[model samples]
Target: MDIISIIAPMILVFFGYTIGSTRIITGGNEALVERLGKYNRKLEPGLNFIVPLVEKIAIEKTTREQILDIAPQPAITKDNISVEVDAVIYWRVFDWVKAYYEVEDVEDAIGNLVITTLRSAIGRQELDETYSSRSEINKTLLEELDKATDDWGVKVLRVEVQEIKLPDSIMESLEKERAAESEKQAAIFKAEGEKQASISRAEGTVQAIEMIAQALKGQSNSKEVLKYLVAQRFVDANQKLGESNNTKIIFMNPKDVSEGVGELLEEDTHISDERIGNGSN
Candidate 1:
């Protein structure tokens, strides 16, 4: 009975030692083993062995990539505009030893660093620039974070500026300014169209006058024809004026227009006769 008790106790001790020393680190995870409270070695995924009671698993962390979402924080722009800014960072641990020992809290340190860098970057740019140059800000953040976190064994894969929110007053002002600008452009375009329409109408009138003069050049009764045309134009003008809602209709004498057309036609005939005489000579 004494021999059996001793052997059974030895077997129990062996089984306890075996169970205590064996560590099954799952895939995508790594562990740091410390010997006598000092970092001794890294335990990779799968079955790992360690000295029981002499060594300990100090920390176990996953090697997979992680996401850090920075909440919206108040920031002042270069132009002294207060705004809210937020971002997201994608990172991973490349060297576990440095990640564990070099920084007290790698995640916290990275987050704080990102906040400081983001503020600095925003402070260097105006509010308008911040909205337009989001890519530039993101690049600056990624570069700064990657450089700063190198010693911490953290690789910042990318940085994204999620949102930049402006105050309601500022947004309303910008909207008003944009609306005013659009109205000004619309007014300019309307004025340009009216001006072009006036030019086209004047050109059409001149062309009609030229065509009438050409048609009447060789006619023997050109003066009579001109008188009829002048009378017709006067009648058409009175008809158009009468069609208007606000126009005052003043009837003109046909005799007066006929007399004016006679005078103009006489002057034109005299000029043409003089030209013909000079050509014959």
Candidate 2:
């Protein structure tokens, strides 16, 4: 019975030692071993053996990729505009030893670094540029963060600027400015159209007068032709005035218009005859 008791204790001790020393590290995870509270070596995934009582795990961390979300924070632009900005950081631990010993808290350190860098980046750009140059800002963040966290054994894969918000007053002001610009453009277009139409009408009148002069030149009844044209134009003018709702038009006798055109044509013919006589002499 004494031997049986002794053998049972031995079996328990052996099993205890074996179970305590054997560590099953899951995939995508790593652990650092320390001897006497000092960093000794890093244990890889799968079956790992450590000397119990003399060795202990200092830190265990996942090597898999991680996401760090930065909360929305206030930043000032180069134009002296205060704005809110937020971002997301994709990172993963590459060297477990450096990640554990180099920085006290990897996640916290990265987050703080991102805040500082983001502010600096925003300070270099104006408010309008901040909205348009989001891709540039994100690229700058990734480069600077990747460079800064190199020693921490952390790799910053990508950075994205989520949203940029403007103050309500600023948005309202911009909307007003855009509306004013649109109205100004519309007015200018209308004025140009009216001006073009007036020029086209003037050109048409000049062309019609030239065509009539050419047709009546060297004709025996040119004076009669002029009288007929003047009477027709006066009748057309009266017709247009009668169509209007607001015009107070005075009607003139057609015989009076014919007499006036005949007198004007006689004066013009006398002037031409005098010019020809002077040239011949």
TM-scores of the models, in the order given = 0.76, 0.71
The residue-by-residue lDDT of candidate 1 on 108-151, one tens digit each, is 99999999999999999998899999999999999999999998
Each prediction's Cα RMSD? 4.8, 6.1
For candidate 2, write residues 1-281 as lDDT tens digits: 68989899999999999999999888999999999889999899989988899999887899998999999888999999988899999999999899999989999999999999999999999998999999999999999999999999999999998987777788898899999999999989976876686578658755764577556756788868876776787687678668866447799897787777667666766788899999999
Candidate 1: list runs displaced more than 4 Å: 131-133, 210-265, 276-281
* Highest-lDDT candidate: 1
Model 1: clashing residue pairs?
none
Most TM-score-accurate candidate: 1
Q: Give lDDT: candidate 2, residue 267.
A: 72
